[model samples]
Target: MANLLSLFKTSGIFHLTPGMVIMWLISLTLIYLAISKQYEPLLLLPIGFGILVVNLPLADLMKPHEGLIWRFYHYGVQWEVIPPLIFLGIGALTDFGPLLARPGLIFLGAGAQAGVYVTFFAANAMGFSVNESATIGIIGGADGPTTIFLAAKLAPHMLGSCAVAAYSYMALVPIIQPPIMRLLTTREERVIRMKKLRKVGRLEKLLFPIISTIVIILLVPAAAPLMAMFMLGNLFREAKVVERLTNVAQNELLNIVTIFLGISVGATMNADNFLQAKIIFIFCLGLFAFCVSTAAGVLLAKLMNLFLKDKINPLLGAAGVSAVPMAARVVHKVGAQEDKKNYLLMYAMGPNVAGVIGTVIAAGIFSTILK
Candidate 1:
């Protein structure tokens, strides 16, 4: 009987708790969404699987120094290696032509960050510390890597929930953003078409990453790690001499880092740390921040139309969160719904890419202030 008891105690079934089951259900739900609903499948599928495995009673996948996932989380996430690498991939894939074509759209990206600051105050008012509030608030930016980077820095305990919330909202950008975009804008504003963007020269393209790096890093030295990698990747793409490097950075390197990043982030959400009421609040605040950010972007675009002779499509502003092409696609789709002839994809890309930089800057600011 003693030997049998010992064996049972070592088994996963015997060690399982209700919380473990609940976490499993949550993981399965994410998996279902990824497979069936096709929501951020690349990251969500791995993340969901990671959540499932980490909750398996005796796995010890996240046991400080002696576990597989723990090592991934420690070196990849905690050491801040993965996010910057992901940014490098993003920079390689990015085209500054759209942003350089119309510098004014950068304002929309800066304006959309209203949600991050607004939610910071809201989260703090609800009893979270300044650091925790800043981490949660970054969900507004809708950039998963930035969220993970900030959460690891400011609230490591809250990393799992915050990352899940950020990615979930990012995945649901289509459903969540359309209503806010519609409610805020008139048909006229949505249908307004801006003029074609002027062709950006090769010299301008090459110079952009170099100048941006110098200016942004000088202003926020804390942002150097991410900003530097991002610009370097962009430089690689523009230089035209490093096709091999650009291809590897955007494709192979990104794919590998993404797997490690997703699994490591998910493993952080074991039952002990994730079943609290605050987790629910984090999800709610994240959604609120996202909605507010969307609304703020649209409103700012309308406000800007008052000054410019060439009235811009207000819907383009909705792409000002860092969801990249996803938010930009949503903006183009919404605008096309109003006027099929109007093409806003390239225009939306301006703010869409700008939002990525804007979010990173916001993270740097938070790290500077809260640290």
Candidate 2:
């Protein structure tokens, strides 16, 4: 009878806590969002499963050395191997043609980073440590890899929450951005179309990554790992002869790293660390940051229109967030709604890709100041 009682004591049922139950529920919600809503299924599915696994009673998935998930977290995320590699894949897939054709759009990308700074101050005022604030602020960039990299370096404890917040907001770009974009820009401004972009030559495409690598790295040395790998991947894409390398970087390599990255990031959200008032605050701050970024981009474009002869569609400005194709698609859709004849996808891609570079630089600035 005593042995039976001991067995019960050692079982998962006896070890369950309210926090674990809540985390499990949260994980289920994430899974629902992924499977049913089709929101970032590639990421949210693994992350939700990881959260459920970690919060399970006596699963030990997040236990130091013995845990399966813990090993992935330590070796992959903690060491910061996955984020930069993700950037490499992004670079391989990115087409710099639109950006090169419209160099002035870089300002739209830079302006969007206002949200990062604004959120940094807000988080600080809310009593988070400077490092924690910095980590949280990068969510404004809407670039999950950059958020993870900065959080891992500056505030490892907040890594999971920040990553989840960043990626969640990224998946919700279509929902969150349009309302703000519509609120900020007039229908006339949304319908405004600029001239077609100039064609970029092959030589220009080949030199861009090299020149950008030299200039950006010189200006922000801390951005080297991400920028270097990103530029190298772009070089592989532009070089044209390295089809195998480009394919691997964008496809196989990216897929493998994403699996490790998503699961590892999720494992960091153990109930004890995640289910708290602090996480609620983080989510709120992250949303504010994302909204502010969209607003900043649109407002900047409007301001620029006043000085320029050829006016740009303010909707395109919202694409400055580093959510890549999603933000761009949202901008394009909004513009299309204003004028069905309008096609802003390629135009939006200019700032959309520029926003990726802008985000990396912004993260480097945060890392430099905090570290």
Evaluate all candidate structures by whole-model CA lDDT and list the values in order: 0.95, 0.92
Best by TM-score: 1
- Output the worst ten-in-a-row residue range by lDDT, candidate 1: 220-229
Q: Across residues 293-332, which tens digit of lDDT does each residue of candidate 2 receive?
A: 9999999999999998889888878999999999999998
Worst 10 residues of 2 by lDDT: 73-82
lDDT for model 2: 0.92
| Residue-level error in angstroms, candidate 2, position 34 | 0.5
lDDT value for model 1: 0.95
Off by over 4 Å in 1: none
Could you tell me how far off, in angstroms, the CA of residue 214 lies in candidate 1 after the best superposition? 0.7
